[model samples]
Target: MGPASVRPAVLVDFGSTFTKVRVVDLRDGSLLASGQAATTTDTALEDGYAAARRSLDPPWDTARPELVKATSSAGGGLRMIAIGLTPSLTVEAARRAALGAGARLIATYSYELTTADVAEICALEPGIVLLAGGADGGNRTAVVHNAGLLAGSAYTGTVILAGNRNAADEAAALLAAAGKGCAVTANVMPRVGELVVAGCRDAIRREFVRRITASHLFRDAAFPVRMPTPMAVLKGLAVVSDGIAGVEPGLGTVLAVDIGGATTDVHSVGAATRRAGVVYTGLEEPHGKRTVEGDLGLRSNATGIVARVAEDPGLATRCGIDDLDRLTAASRQLAAHRSTVPATADQYTVDAQLATAATALAVGRHVGHLTVQHGVTGPVRIQEGKDMRESAGLIGTGGVFRHAADPESILKGGVADERWPSSLRPVSPKFYVDREYCLFAAGLLADDHPHAAFALASRGLEAL
Candidate 1:
């Protein structure tokens, strides 16, 4: 094929366990052929990419996708531990910011954290450590105290100070003076409830790039191409929504659920609307819109799923306690392993059920936070009139989601659905592919046809 007709490209979809390569014909968005193989984690990347594409694609197309890039949760991604001033205050905001930027918080510490806590943070071997405290100027002492503790810990990684802005520069200098390469960013806790993401996001990305390049583990520079699997999924979904739904689709938000072995991620996005020309009592409206609930995930927090499934009598009656423990454990393994779940009947049933429960739970929490809520024992699908479909696109992702045998199992056939209650809009579910994250074909499409990318984004968004 000539240069114009050749339009040859490479699409790399990095999953937790595997990576996929597709050779495409851009003229009509055709996936002319494809390649897929396990993520060669332990080997040099130059050879690994070569090996993965050896059989799945041809010589030229396999060499580089013209777009030889990717998204992943597999490796070279941020693994962190966050210390917050309050239990569910700054910590929560910090968590959301981390998630939005694609970093995974292995653990979160709130008030009254002790030396044992600092010792523990040092042991996690995370790529980075996020320290956020009482809102700006609110808890300067605690923030400084935590900074002091981290300065002494064995955490050789970068230390990001995201607390009282007034003390930030001093804190950064102090940490630097303490022999730690300090990273200073805007306060994660700009206020009590709202999170300010710009500064920290930049710092995290920079720290991430620096850490990967410095680590003996990443030997090859392929590390920088890694996008947080969730963030990649989020970006892909954003593209899909913009293309498919258009601007004035009357859609309020786009809701996505990624039910993993250890974490379930639910994101709700929509146009920001102010009520009565006045701000509400307890809400952070950014650009008149919002994205909520990163604390409520399925994988690492599987026990939360048990508490949720326990509350739903119908869901509870579906299985035994032994399976709950086993399932959660498997999910945790899945999160750590970061790969596809087998597509078999028995596994499929369990996967679907768990995903449904996680999605419903995450969505429930996100919606309720925008309003207000009780504990997991609360008996409500959503707060009164809170509009679950504010962002109409309902994209389902994660290992189970991409490989699940039947998505309808959780889509609620009607009111008789034993899973989620009837308040949330039942928009048709869809996916975008970041093979390592979940194979929703986002990579393949993005490789073959740039035009179709946006069209795929808006799938299933009835309200948007």
Candidate 2:
């Protein structure tokens, strides 16, 4: 590495609650600086962006930064509606496909016969409506029903049909004939239980692109709201894996987990692996992130954590019901409700425990409940046949890890994310989520200064 004191490029992430800034030295991969500011995107986009940008920018008097870039979940991501014939099967498949494409699933319905339901879906005003139902050899009633619903709708959004391959041509024509603008794809639930998500996933992406042009990002065009932040992250991870083993390490392999408030996302990369995916989200439930325990977020889903953990035997003992109740209550206002600074030791313990459980559950689900941990491991990289010890890296992101009181406290929080924090003690470890590190910012770092991304992620992030 040349001069370690070189200026660094910055990555900025504007979330609903916090706007994070991270800097990575491209020459040496050393993380330079990170900071956050409360975000109030709901108030107004122009104002929100102005404040967020200020929060992200280092003191003007400090060192002039290399470059500043950004991504945001503000103004809501892309929104979507999934339509299928069967409530659980095809509709579920459509939901998966939509979510994978980075669209937020707002509603799903199957077609049996429902004029009222059709009216309801139309009123949701989704950016995209994914229509899927029946198998290639199955009945057309469900698909036709959904098509009929969109026939006279005022919504001019993209409608992707991911259903029976045989009916694709007909479905396209039908939806169009019904005055619905539509895109057709093979069945998301192709063969009985088999899900052909690739086609629909592609269509969803197309729809996002089609809609992004008009979103808040562009004042002149339609914008995509409710687009899958996790989906984009997954795609970015795939890009990294492809570049790593295929480009950098030549025979690279890796595993990743993005522990979020509402969900914990897992992605893997390897030579043997052909692609990246969200292996699981709420894979380990009643054990999700503490901050987002409910559908409401820090501002809305605060009560979810308490409600979920209430069912767990672990929380009951580790954190008394009274404490649990308090945190659960506080989580709702987590975004902006600043009150009651943690004073008591027990309060601190509970706060740590709640964050800990969320992280562990997310991490565990990402790696899967490994019956054995001696497969492969590494520092910032991994290789095939390495096993758990060979996992190139275990990256942690999100606010919980970032706002941790200290590194040791973060480690304890890691233990909570994982039932056993010591599970991977022998492996090289570092965490990059401090008041100073942001993954999206680091992801920007990971793009050019991967080594630095590795370094900071190792040092600042809590290691179990």
Candidate 3:
């Protein structure tokens, strides 16, 4: 068959504010056209989807694609609460699995559940409760106790049991007796200091898909929402970082940041390469890591960003803010008017400063750090988190970067410098912009058309 005869596929991302659509030629993974419309999540999602579809150019707008796939973060993504036995081991493991699965981790609790904790969980109303504790053959008492508490609680979310293997059946039976939804998966930490989250991640994704399909918000949409928007982006980054063997060459050690209205998500894919004389500590970092900063956002959390900057005078000055009071007022206005675009020069400057501060703070929290400890012989450097200083490329996405006149300057806020020699942020990496917003689309195509996904991602990015 010739290229002209090959049918394209339509990919849609139901974002919090916008419904983005892309048409990709299945033959070569080339993007044909793209369009976006204000998301009608408060109403019918199909209204926005249809509008975006109609906004496309030429026959592409009218002609039907071969297949349609979708992802969504319209209703604040997949909200989840993770509960575990210990803060350092099981709790941390559950946190990683939840975030890596593209879930918006609302809260995390350690130790046995108390009455107040159960009340808080009920009030939070998460879509999923990630119950993890103990190792595969380790202490099973905590997990079983937690299961009993959750079963008797008013929380209606699905309980994902990724704790002790020995206690799995009992936990499942307890939840089932209460008529609560439960899913049993592999232990998140099968052994001490050993993490096994793939099964849990898969279980989370399955639950996400099930909820999305069942929700009335997306019932009338033409395509089924397959995964969360963050998950789709993560999948695309995986393909970029670890390309198919002999088909596509992977980009080694890559970092990508997505700054949004309510959060800033940082995704890094690669092996953690420790420098000589540095001792790595803490839980082993995953090859593909994603961190979401709920407090760092340009719109809904603008005030939070301003507050963070106020604590660091130097950072505030670097962001071009002279008066904290003025910036604080501007942040309030931005937060109040979520959809308002920067009209005046001062407003634009405020937005830029906030974006810069958000990126810097979010990335700082995401990357690993080095701490020097003085010993008898010499100072020892201890590294915690993933080392991404040697990243090959840094890609910027989301509305802040997409609309900025100088995105490179905003992105530079995340780079490391001599001021703090501990942060392992990317340095001297090539900058790229997701000009076409095809990363999620590429990820949606990754499972079925990997080569095509790689081709689209490669061609869609514009180097700065």
Candidate 4:
């Protein structure tokens, strides 16, 4: 298409604190302009979106884009609680599914639900309850019992049943009798040591979209907000990692860490590199995986980050946090005023330290680690989770990284060093920053315009 004939697309992200807007050229996937405004979820999402639109540069502010797509994390995002039979197998599977679906997992309960557990679940009032237990055709008692408990509780949210196939009907019938909303999907752990979460993830996405559409903020037909913000970022990262067949060259293995107000999310896309003399255990890691560290946030949960750093002296040293009392005070102040930006040098240092610590902790939990097991012959090495040591690129998102003077220093906190030989973190990754915050935009365009999405990701990711 000619340059004059080329159109532009508008992408929006309704984050908890800020509503970000980006305008991109549909022809070459080049970013044209961007704007940000405080999110007004309590009032109306449209208000914030309109303000962001008005802040755009030049023609983008006045001209109407050919299409508008949005992703949101407003109103505390999609809050969910996961219930499963076991902590290791089913509960972990449920957690993965919930995180992959872009839901903030508030709590997780294992085994049978007690009265206290049900009460806590009711009090939390999560938008969705992911009920998963046992493999297909395995134990059915726990799942069925949990369903009955949920049905009898004061919780009025949707219950997603992703457990034993044998007990599906009974559980559905129980929820139906109680007039509770339930979505039945394939078991998250269909068999022992197998994790199949795509079905549950899809179900959660459906519920999320339904919730968004039902809300007054997204009632306008002109604005279509589809997936959650994290989900969009995940999709965009996947596209960058695994390029379109015969169209673009993939970036091979890649990692992205999004540090936010309430959580820090780590996403990796690529296969775990097979190594010699290493035995894989537990569930096989998904090609596209995401893990959210609820306690590792820069704003709302800054105190948690400070506490974590204080607990681990090595982490504190690595993050260059020598003054725990100062960090603690700053974290408390930042938590109290969530919108406060780093003004003084001390505040900037505090933010950097928190970001570094959060990146290190979150990525450590997300990546796999090696352990030695004594076998018949000798000691054998076992690996659990993905090995991301060979990741081609590491991208840092969020305000901390985008506005930092040295983003590479914060990004390096997640890299594996000689001190932790077992961690499977990227050792020598090419660092990049999402300066324009166009990952969501690329993701929104990926399905229909693969080439454009790929081009956009390639251009938008600024190498450090």
Best-matching candidate per TM-score: 3
Please identify which of the two predictions, 2 or 3, would achieve the higher lDDT against the true structure.
3
**Reference-based TM-score of each model:** 0.74, 0.65, 0.96, 0.95
The lDDT-based order of candidates, best leading, equals: 4, 3, 1, 2
Q: Local error of candidate 4 at 265, Å? A: 0.9
Model 2, 322-427: lDDT tens per residue? Answer: 4665676566555345433456675455455555555444343333322223435522222211123344444545544445465343333333234444232114
TM-score comparison, 2 vs 3, better candidate:
3
lDDT of 3: 0.88
Root-mean-square deviation of every model: 6.2, 8.7, 1.9, 2.0
Return whichever of 1 and 4 wins on TM-score: 4
Sequence-dependent TM-score of model 4: 0.95
Clashing pairs in 4: none
**lDDT tens readout by residue for model 1, 76-154:** 3579777777766777667666767667778888874689998888788887778888777676877777777777777
Candidate 4 local lDDT, 36-65, one digit each (tens): 898987778988988998887643643566
What is candidate 3's lDDT per residue for 1-464, written digit by digit as tens?
11457668989999989999988888889888788898987777888988998887543643556879999998888999999889999999999999999999999999899989999999999999999999888889989999999999998889999999999999999999999999999999999888889999999999998987678786553357888999899989888888889877988888889988889999989999868888888789999999999988888999999989888888876666778899899889889998888777777777778888887888889999988999998999999998889998888988778778788888888888776588988988888888889899999999999999999988888899
lDDT score for candidate 2 against the true structure: 0.52
